[model samples]
Structures are given as structure tokens and as C-alpha cells.
Target: MDAGSMKAESRCPLQEQFLQRKNSKENLDRFIPNRSAMDFDYAHYMVTEGRKDKENNQAMSVCSPSKEAYRKQLAEVFNMNRTRILAFKNKPPTPVELIPEMHSSSASASSSVQQAKLNKPRRHIPQSSERTLDAPDLVDDYYLNLLDWGSSNVLAIALGSTVYLWDASDGTTSELVTVDDENGPVTSVNWAPDGRHIAIGLNNCQVQLWDSTANRQLRTLRGGHRSRVGSLAWNNHILTTGGMDGLIINNDVRVRDHIVETYRGHHQEVCGLKWSASGQQLASGGNDNLLHIWDRSMASSNSVTQWLHRLEEHTSAVKAIAWCPFQSNLLATGGGGGDRCIKFWNTHTGACLNSVDTGSQVCALLWNKNERELLSSHGFTQNQLTLWKYPSMVKMAELSGHTSRVLFMAQSPDGCTVASAAADETLRFWNVFGAPQVISKSAPKPNREPFAQLNRIR
Candidate 1:
């Protein structure tokens, strides 16, 4: 063959093969699937399959030869495959039920919670007096404070012109001293805070001091009060005396010039006198229906008046005065028969905090040391002792035994027992302020030692 013919023949075979490959690629393209159908059409088909299945089942039931025959045939096919594949392979286990014991414990816990919600706090009720003693010839005078309980557990009372000391431990009585009839009867009696000395106020306006243990007259504080001395209070070494002269004198017992300071505020007789526990303030009530609070600094100052607060809220005479031991600024004062009210004042601001109409003549007021309670002695219709809750002023209990008015009440140093002397000539001991006690014979008795030596001037 010729060279040109051979080359032409080879080129013709190659072109044929290329044409064949091109045709094969076009054929495969027609059979292969597209991603559009797989992504969009397949997802739409799956979402609509449930509705289509319901329609198909309904149509198949009507078109089929028999519905029972179709279901039985499908069940037979599924049962045959059940041996190779299990149903509900990923199902969770069942939860266990609670036991009977656990149910009972839960119910009990709920009941206890309910019970605690229904409980409330209860208040305390004070008891009545434990015992009573005869105080024959006890002078029933409203202006006089004749009953005083010493720290040594001895109670001193003035009956007529004689001063008697009653030992509470032994239940025995002894005469301390007696004044002449010409010098007048004892108007008031006060014991020193140390329990060693006793102050006797006479109707003749003479103040006498006596050593309680030795039973000897220490000295007579003279030229202090012109009129009858009705009240007396001891503040350490200084003795304070208030009298009908409407004057309050501060006498230093250790010094010769005992009349150190004199306070004048009331126009009527000064009847009530009390020194605060801190010895910083002095409260005095008078027949002028006035209450005065004095400061300790006034004694050393040159001011004309040493009165801290001048209160005039009472319409009648104010003979009952008591300074609160817990609150220093609180002061309580009771009016006479005409007013018949108990007034509480704040000494700091000179303001009246509260006042209660007792409905009867309030003779004296005593605050409990251990509890927030107040005790009041009354006269007239209800000649009894009423224990009241402070601030609220609620009457907790009413103790009635005395036929006459209770004029004076004195608390022991222990702040438990109280001795009340009434017009019935009886001195009753009440545990109204504290709990009852049964003192045994083996208990160590309180020391009856005498106080430090005083400057005796016979």
C-alpha cells in the first residue's frame, strides 16, 4: 500500500473510537440520579407519606378481594421475619413503685410540719403571796414609808412609837429602838443599801441613824428639815431627807457640815424620795402634785436650781415614786386618791411616756428585777395588790387579802420576796415578784455582820 493511504486509514479508526466514548458518556448521564430529587423531593415525600398511607390503605381495603384476607397475609409475612429481627429494640426499662414503709414515713413527716405551724408562745402568770404575818399597831399613814427590808434578810417596821426588827430566817422579832411620846411617833423608816445602818424619820422633824447590828443610835441629823421629815433615802455616805418644809436636803454623814446641798422645787410637803441604783439621779414626789428629777452634778455646781426635770402631770399628791432598775431614764409615779392613776415618765426628755388609770388609789409601785413586770398596791374599792405587765400595762393577776389599803411595800435585797404593810395591821410576805423557795436548815445563813465604823457623836 502507499504511505498516504496508510496514514488516512489510522486517523479514521481513531476518530471512530472518540465518537464511541462521547456517545457512552451521554447515555450514562440519562440514567444517573440528580441531587435536587434526593434533597427536596425525598424530604417532601417522607413528610406526606403518613397521609398517603392512610388514603392508600382505605383504597386498598375497598379494591382488594377481601380486607381480612389482606391483613392475614401481611401478619403471616411479618411473623415469619420476627425470628430474625426484634421489635422495640431501644425501649427503656419500667420505673419501680414506692414501698409501703416509704409512704408511711413521708406522711408522718408532713404531719409534724403541720403541727409546728399551729403552736404559739405562752405568757407567764405570777403566783400569790407565800405567807403573812401580824403587824399589830402598824401606823396606816399614806405619807409615811415605815416598812423596809434589809439586805441581811431582816425586815424593820415601825408600830406606834417602837421600831421592831423581824428576822426572816429565824421568824423571830426584836425591838430595835423606841422614841419618847413627846418626840412624836416614827413617821418613816429606811435602811442603808449596805444593810448595816437604819434611818428613822420622826414626826418632830428629827432624823436619827442607828447601827442595825449593834442596836445603837449612831447620830442624829439635826437642823436639816424644819417640819416633820416624811421621807428619807441613803446614797452611799450621803443621806437625803425630804420633809413637810417642802425642802430636800443632802446630808453627808462622814462630814461635820452634813447639810451639803438643799433642793427646793415643790410648794407642798415632799413625801416620796428614791435614789436610783446608779446613784446618778434622784426622784422626789411631793404633795404639790409635782415630780422632780435631780442630777448628781447639781450638787457640785453653783446653779440656783439643780432640778433636771419638773413634771406636773398628776392632779393630786404624788407619794409613790420608783426608778426602773433596767431602764435608767424610766420613772414611775402614782397619784393619790383624787387622781388614781399611775404615770410613767422618761427623765431624759422630760416627756410622759404612758399613764394608766388604776381605778383606785395607787399607794406604791415596785418593778420586778428578774422580769419585765410591775407591782402596784391599791386602796378604796379594791384594796389589793395587782401585778401588771409593763409597756402593755396588762393586769396579769389581782391579789386580794388585805381588808384595808396597802400603804407601804418593800422588796428584799434578793428581789424575790416583798413585805407589804396595810391598814389592817398586818405585814404580808408575797412571792409575787419571784419563784417560791423552801430554805433548808443546812443552807448557810446570811452574814449579820455590822457595817464599817461610823463617826459616832453621842
Candidate 2:
């Protein structure tokens, strides 16, 4: 090769190396402090030594190619490290601190969803009545279950000493049987499940079975109670009667010696008696402010331990007792003047599930078979009937009409109608338990005025 060409190529490599070293020194000074000062000292040494070597040897290079190459490599590495440090210092912020915030947001969202489910709106139900009839001379006793509507659409009511049968379909009333005044007045009345036989409980402590269709007394079962018989309930051929003597008797109507089983739990008058729809459980409430739950298996045993659960939460008389048609384990009972509370119990576990203050004396409680609703009849201040939505216990409607307190209530076989007997000497049929109806724009509403008025007997 020619000398000029070789010299130019070697000078080019040295110039490029020097340029790279100069740029790296500038970057180091801008990015790092103490390291930049060291790089400046090394650069000064290279420049001064190169000038001296050039003067001493004209044909040779100012510095050894190997040392120059090494310096260049060090400069390249420093530039790369400087670039990395600058990138790290200028990088964007991370979201590491937001992890807890994300969790809290999710937790709040789940709580909101659960609350929305609990507060969901319920269906709006209308309150109205279908018909009303006068229950003349109807006893006003709170402890007596004087009214019962049979499955055959016949209503049997005990007014004083007379037992009357009124055919709901034909509106014809007939006297079933009249008890002797010596038997004290008929305190309670209940019909058999088959709607063929009716049980009459007397103030004389006697329970009698009668064939209502034939208008004949079948037989009188004695040794029921020491005082007045106040309540009666029937499960098939077995009739249960509660009395003022605080005694409960179960009579099997199919046999002659009808007194099959006896239960003694209350210290005061046994005023309420009800059998579950399945006839597996019997719930009785008494004036002693106590509630007793009895299982059918207890009927076979003559032992005093037949009492399943003796609940004493009520401070006053517990004359209101009912078995839930939907839940067999559930039983509801209400207290009188002093307590004024309705408590629901799980009979299987003997746990009180819920309780509600009625604001007045709760005289009677009835469950609607068609809907998840409960009807509670009240006495004292308002003397009103309240329809409540079950489980939630929201008051759907308050019915007012009876001038006196409604002490007794009954449900019809269809499950859409309810008959409430009040001290006003009137029997009112309410459609409050019926399913809500939808009225179209073209159809006109019926006259609701009759429902509010008293329909006295002709």
C-alpha cells in the first residue's frame, strides 16, 4: 500500500476514537459527578502523552493502537452505563401502592350488591273485602275460638248457647244445635277436617261431637277439663280440646272411649289450640303467658314428659296460636294486653325465630295458604286488622271497620277469603288474603263502598 493511504486510514481510526471519548466525557459530566472528574483526568493524560509521542516518532502513532482501543472500549461501557442510569432516574411511577386500594374497592362493591338484594322491592298487594254478615250475639271472649269456616264452605259459629251453621254458597243460615244454659255457654267450636263432623266445646268442660249435615249430636266425650272448654282443633278422627282448667285432651272420635291422650302443661287457662297441616305438631297457647308445642308421638305416651317445648317468652296471655302451612317446623303465637307481641318459633329446634310488636293486643293470627302472608287481628286502641307480608313482616294493609276489637279470625277453604269476628257483633269476609288482581284500562273498578259498610243480618 502507499504510505499516504496507510497514514490516512490509521489517522481516521484515532480520530473516531477521540470523538467517542469526548462525547462520553460530556455525558458522564452531565449524569454523574465524582465519576466525571476521574474521566476528565484520564482524557487530559491521553491528549498530553499523544502530543509528546507524535513529536518523538514521526512514522509511528501518537499512542499504542492497543491502549487506544482499550480506552475506546472503556468509554463505550461508561456511555452505556450513563444511558442506563439516566433512563432509571426518568422512568414513570409504578402502581404498587394501589393494590390495597383495589381490594377495598372490590369489597365495597360486593357489600353494595348484597344490600341491593336485601332491599329489593316487594309486590304491591291491594286490601279489600268480598262480603260481610252479622254475627249476632257472638261471644266477645278473647280466649274463645268461636268461629270456624269448614272445607265444605259452611261456617259454624257459637253465639251464646246456640251453634249456628251458615251455608256460604246459598247464604242460608240454620241452627245446628243449641246447648243447655246449664252447660254454661258454648265457648268454642271447630269442624272436622273432612267437613262432616263438628266439635263443640262447652263452658261446662265437656266436648261434644255432632253430625252437622244431619243436625244430630253424635256423642258427648266427658272428662276433658275441670273448667270451661275454650278452644278446639281436629286432626282427622282425633279431636283436641283446650279448656280454662289449663288441661288439653285428645279424643279419638272413631272409638267409644274417645279420651285417647291428655296433656297438662299450662298453669292457667289453655285458650288456644292448633294442629299443623300435616297433623304432626300441635301448638297450644294459654292465659298463663306460656306456649306449649306437642308432637304427635307424644300422644302415644302417657308420661308427663310429653311436653315438647314450654316457651315462656310472653308476659301476658298467649291466646293466639297458629301452625304455618308452608313450614311444618314453624309455629306462630301472639300475646295479649301486656306483651302485645307475636313470636314465631321453630318447633323442631325450639328456637324463637322472630318476634314483632303489634302495638296493641294481638288476639288472633292466621296464615294465608295461597301466599306468604299473615293476618293478625288486634284489640284495644285501633281495633284494626293488619295484613303482613311473611318473613319480611312488612305491613301490607290495615283494615278498619269493626267498632270493637276483632278477637277471632278464620280462613276459608279456597284460601282467598278470611272471616273475622269482632266485638261489634259482626262477621266480615275480607279478600285481603287473595292474590293481587290486574285491572285493564277498559275495565271499570267495582264499587268499594259496600266493603266499608256494615252488612247486618236481615
Candidate 3:
């Protein structure tokens, strides 16, 4: 009895030490190791350690495909990877090879293959008409998508719920990154002209600025809007926001971003805002049908105390405004255009000049560089986009094809494209088709009854 017991005790410590030494380096048992050797019950300690590890990692760890030997077990857990996929042997696929259908694959299995395939140097395909030898890199079916031109990268916002990015060089609708804010809906989003940051206006009256480059949200602006901020315009570092409660806020969009002042004069909801090309003054239009111009050069305190000019025209709600790109003193109103009524105002005097009859309610307004010609879009029902034809007020082209209410319209910075976002869930591209092909006074009608009856039989 004495000899056998002593021999067993002696073997226990050596075995335990060897197991501990093996585990400390194998990368598997390094996370969990049995330490007790005096009890000669190493299985008990193993069970205890295994239970602890499982309890700590139940939500994260997954069993590894490798063998789990007597002294150690292999496990994997979800983790943030600092090591780049780019460092691997495989590169990302070329832009031309990225097909939307590839996204249907599960990320886990596809990611590794995708990275390798993308990183691999592409081989030029030899072009041929009928399988005869031809020059390489001359394939007819090389692929690329137009959306690829807008933004190569995107910033995820609202706790990784939404994304926002420039779609292309055109300053049209920002790729609207939607966040699951319980369908709270975003009232407005303003990207700084420099493209550094984006300010998102939430339906809950809270404002959040996302740092695009860092891809992490910095902070939130509380007490947001009196109601949700409806319009946001940026002039360099200063942000002017218009809200439903008739409160126009002047915010300092800096690292210590805060509301510097609030200008309250609009009797009803403030609907629109525009910064003069010179950036010295800001023009805002509201539901009160009044246009108010604020001189940005005024000190923050003065801004709140000063009430610039009260434009007392436009009998109905002043829905939209855009400053002339060339003329600092001129502003265009979109609510009323043509015979239906679009108002062009002299920013300096706040006086309405030349009420053009657009034959439809103005839904959006945009000005080109010289500011002589005004491009206006009417509501979705008629789907007419008219160019004021400069000082002449003649009708230009009337664009069609949008089936639902056109909710928003924006012009690209280069003036090469006009984008309209509508309730039909579509984005359309319209440009200079040149020369009118169709004409209508109010709405579309077949020239059948009167004109056909009078016409001679052919």
C-alpha cells in the first residue's frame, strides 16, 4: 500500500508540469490550464477550468475544426481583425469584376475566396472575333457600374445602422444611408462642402455629426430642433438649420460644435435655406410665405438680435430656395414658378422680381454658374422639368417618366446632370436633350376632338 501510493503521488506532479508546459505554448490550452497536482485528480480541475471558459465565452466562442486532445481543446471566438485582408496573398477583385450577384454568397465562406481573387493580379484576356488570335486587354464585355463613380467608400452611422457617402462628383442626392431608427426617418442630412463630416437631422429632433474619415460617430447634438429640422445648409464652418417651429439655428460646426444662436421670426414652419455664393449672407424661406435673408458676417449675438429683411410676398407657403451661383444678390424660389408662379427675388432688397408663370407648382430650383438661366422642376404628377430659358422666360424642355410625386431634385456641381428622387423609389438622370419635342399648357391631352375635326382628310 505505501509503495504504490508514493509512486502514484510522484508521477502526478511531473505529469501536471509537463501538461502545463505543453499547454502554455500550444495556443489552445494557453487559455485554460489545470494547476492542482496534490489531489491526483487532474480531471476535476480540467472540468472546472472548462466550465469557467465556457461560461465566459458562451456567446462568442465556436468549436474549432481541429482535434481536441486529452490535455487541451481548440476554440475560436469572434474578434476584431487588425490584420488586413490586403496583407494576405489574395487581393480584392478589380472594380470591373465586382458583380452585384456575388454579394448573394454568405460572407463567411466568400470573404476568404473574394480577398484572394481580388488581390491576385489580373490577366489580360486576348480579344478575338471568332476565336482567332487578337490583341489582349481588348475585351468588349468589361464591366463597371455608374454608382461606382459616386463614392468608393461609405460611412456607417446610427450605431452602424445607416450609411452616407458621396455617390459621385455630382453634388446631388447624397447616397442616403438609412439607419434603423425605428423608422423614425431622417428629416435632413448636410454634408460639409469639404466632405469631411456629415450632419444628420433625426425625426426625434436630435442632430448627429459623423466623422466620415474615421468611420466612427463622434457625438450627438441634443435639444435638436424645436420640431425636426427640415432644412440644413452649410457655409464653411457655420451651419444654418431651419425647423418646423419657426426656429432658425446658427450652429458652429467645429470640433466643439454647438448652437451659437437661434433666430426666431418666421410665423410658421421654416421650409428652406440657401447660402449666397459669396458666403456673406444666408437666405431662408418658410411656410409663412416670407423670405428672410440673414447676413452671416454679423456676430453670433447680432444674428439672434438682428432680423434681416422680411420678404413679404408669395401668398402661399415658400417651399424651396437656392441662391444664384454667380449673383450673390439674387435668390430663386421654387414654390411658385411660371403661370403657376415661380418667384425670383433680389436678395439685396427682398423684393420679388419677375414672377414667371411655370404652369405648375414649383417643386425644386437650381442655378447654373453664370446665374442667368434657372432650372426648375415641377411636382411629380405632371413630371415636367423646365428651364426658365434665362431672362426670356420661354419654356425649355419638359422631362417626363417619373410615375409618382417627385419628392426632391438636385443638380450636379458640374451642371452636367440633374437628379430627381421621387416617392416611386427611383432616381432618374436628365440632361440637355436639346429642343422641345412636346408642349402642354397645363397637363397632357390628346389633340383629337377640335384639331382632328378641323384637319382635312388625308
Candidate 4:
């Protein structure tokens, strides 16, 4: 079978070996320049000469033609005139009015009038308090919110086991209610929007709604929290209460089943609660060094409601919460003794916009309803009230009279006065914020010259 076939097989191996070596040599030769074919020295000389020519051209460009002429030359050389004509690198300014007419006299007059309004004199604030009253037995606990001013111009404050109300209009003081030994001390008190109904939080985990006009209890709400209710805020018909059990409950006062929604997040007592002016959001601060934002639209009675934001930026307990009167999204919260800082937050985005170190404990915060200013009550070494300009945070004035820590502060209905109750047991009212501006609608009639009336006689 054969010598011929065996010889053919032997020849096949030699042919394949030759092809393999040839392919390898071809690949290796691809990267190597052709030394014999290409003029290496000439190529190098051309590159060097071209580089020198470019440098010389760049040097001569010091006295070159204008940019427009150069662009025209480029367009001509490349036949790009059509493309250049269609492109607009800089557009002309837009006309304010369609028809060309001069408005100089009227425009200048209106602008001058606006400038005069802008230059109005600044209001004056008194350095000393205008009045002072005795707040005997006012609770000194930092975690308890025991003072609030109602829209009715009535201020309610809790003292030990009894709650008292003072009418700011007539300067009358009256007792609101007193809890028994079991539910001894009142933890918090807030007035509803109607100003006639008040919500009283008790140490025995009870919330009472009372009618100030009739001076009678409306009802008692239970099954909301397991510990003492320390903070209370009202939104329309709904009453929000935060308790020592780290729970926030929304009670709808109109329905018999008052416990409507519950917010569960904080691990410690919630001491601060404030509803925004729009009544769409609620901000709560607790002893766990946490701040939570709850949205009313997301709340449900069937399940535990989720918080819109859980801000853990505070290093200590947060008790002071105030929503800006001018801006709905801006919120201000103050940290307790350990933190000694006031932080501004954008509630919609949950971003901390600014923070200022107060150097002392911030116990309460109140915003002027008529002005863009803020008032803060501090404790410990200073025990003074600070009036600050918002956004700038400049210390406008520092009023000091309390001998002990200023634990509570409330603003008057007109936002002209601030009542501060300190651990010193004295309630001092300051005329810090000036009276609201009164706009005059009446304008003086222009007087006619004597000769101007002679035209009618003629």
C-alpha cells in the first residue's frame, strides 16, 4: 500500500512547515520600516523643516490681518462661505418693545418712586422689657413644652400641676385646669387655630381638648402613647401629639375614633413638634437626637405611616422647632445643651442649608409673623434672649433680664412683643419686634396754579 503514499505524507509535513515560517516572518516584517525603500534622512529633514516653517508663521502672525479677514480667507479657500453665512456665534440683543418709542420720563419717575420706598427708615426696638409678670412654679424641665400663645391673644402656661391662661388684650389671668396627683403635671399646651379650643398634654399620657370660650373640657384622648405626652401641635381639625414613648399620633378631633395616624421612628422621647404654615407637613424632634418630617398625604390609619425624612444631624437632643413665616419650605431647628447649634433645613429636599453655633443651649425658637426676623431663647450661662436677622443670622439684639435659664418663649398675636418665661419664675415681655407697617391709602390732591383755573372762567 505504498511507498508513493508514504512519500507524499513526508512531503506534506515539509510544505506545512514552510508555510508556518513564512506567515510568522510576514507578521514580524509588518511593524519594521522598509529601510531600503523609504528615505529615512530625507523624511526627517522634511519634518524638521516643516516644524521650523510653522514656528516662523506663528511669529509673523503678530501683525496679521483681523479675525474677520482671516475667516473670510478660510471660507474662500475651503469653499465654506455657505456654512459660514448660516452660523451665528453672537446674536443681537432682544428689543423690549415692538414699536420704538421713548419712555424715559415715565420710567425714570417710577424708578425714583420705588427707590424712595426702598430707603424707608429702619424700625427701632427697645432694649429693655416693657412689662414683666410672675410665672411662679413654671416647670423647669428642658424636655417639656409648657408655654404657647394662641391666636386669640391668650397665653397658656403649665405650672407644676395646674395650667393658667393670661389674656393679653385685657391683661387678665385665669386658671385653665389642674390635673390630679396621678396625672399631676402638665407637659405641653397648644392653642388651636380658632383660638377658643386648647390642647393640654398631661404627664399621664393623656391629651385634653378644652373650650376656652366656655371654660369646659371637650374630650380626653387616649390610646395614643404609652408615656407622657410632651409636645403638641395643631393643624386645622387635627391635633398632633408627641410623647415620651417615642411615638407621634395624629388625632382627628372631629371623629370619635380620634387616633387616626401614628408616626414611629424615634427611639426616645419626642420633645418638639411643629406643623408648617401650609398644614401639609409636620416636623418633630426627639431626645434620640433625630428630626423627622411627616407628610400628611402619606399618612394612613390602617398602617404605620412612614416619615418623609429622618435627619440625624443633631448631636444632642433637639427641642426647638420653628417654621419660617415667609418661606414654606424653610425650617429652623435648634439642638439642646450638648449641640448648641441652630440648623436650617429645606424640608422638601431634606438638605441642611445652614447651621450656626449659638455657644449655649437653645431652648425655644419663634419667628416674627410680620417681619423676617427670628427670636431664640437660650439657657445655661447666658440665659438671654437673642434677636437674629434671618439668612444673614446677624445678632441684632441680645436682651437679658432673667436670672435663670430662659426655658420658654411665645410671640404676641400681632408679632410686636415676645413673652419669655425663665426658670427664674419671672415672665418678661419685650418690645423687640417693632409694630407692623401701616400702609396709607390716602394721597394728597395736587394743587392747581391760580392761572390754570382762569382757563375755565374764559
lDDT of each: 0.80, 0.77, 0.54, 0.82
Evaluated at residue 25, the lDDT of candidate 4 is 32
* Ten residues in sequence with the least summed lDDT for candidate 4: 12-21
* TM-score of candidate 2 against the unseen true structure: 0.68
- Over the full model, what C-alpha lDDT does candidate 3 score relative to the true structure? 0.54
Considering summed lDDT, which 10 consecutive residues are worst modelled in model 2?
A: 12-21
- Cα lDDT tens digits, model 2, 1-458, are 99867754654210111112233226554543344334554455456664575454443334576665665587588662231211213233332332233458787786666667556555444453455666666788888989999878898888778888878788777888888889958999998876757889898888877777677776787876788899898876678888888888887766667777889898889988988888888889998898999988766645543789989889999988888889888888899999999899999989999999989999999898867888999999999889888999998899987789998988877677788889987777787765534545564433222111422211
- Please tell me which predicted candidate would have the highest lDDT against the true structure: 4
Whose TM-score is greatest here?
A: 4
Alpha-carbon RMSD to native, per candidate = 40.9, 33.2, 31.1, 31.0
CA RMSD (A), model 1: 40.9
lDDT tens digits by residue: candidate 4, 1-458? 69867754544210111112233336563354444455445456545664585566566666675744675587589644331212213343333433334478877676666667566676787776777777666788999988888878998888778888888888878888889989969999998876778899999999988877778787899888889999999887788999999999998887678888999999999999999999999999999999999998999999999999999999999999999999999999999999999999999999999999999999999998787888999998989999899889999999987889888888887788898888877778899988855658774443222112222110
TM-score of each: 0.70, 0.68, 0.56, 0.71
In Å, residue 18's CA in model 3 sits off its true spot by: 68
Clashes of 4: 0
lDDT of 3 at 279: 78
Candidate 1 per-residue C-alpha lDDT over 1-458 given as tens digits, one digit per residue, 9 for 90 to 100? 99867754644210111112233236554344444334344345546674576577677877785874776588587542122221223334343333323458777676666556444334344454556666666777888888888877888898878888888888778888889997768988998867878899998999988987888998888998888888999888878999999999988877667888889898989989999888888999999999999988767624445699999899888999988879988988999999999999998889999999999989999999877889899999879998889989999889887889999999987787787889987777787765644556585654332234545644
Clashing pairs in 1: none
Candidate 4, position 336, lDDT: 93
Off by over 4 Å in 2: 1-128, 435-458
Per-candidate count of clashing residue pairs (backbone under 3 Å)? 0, 0, 21, 0
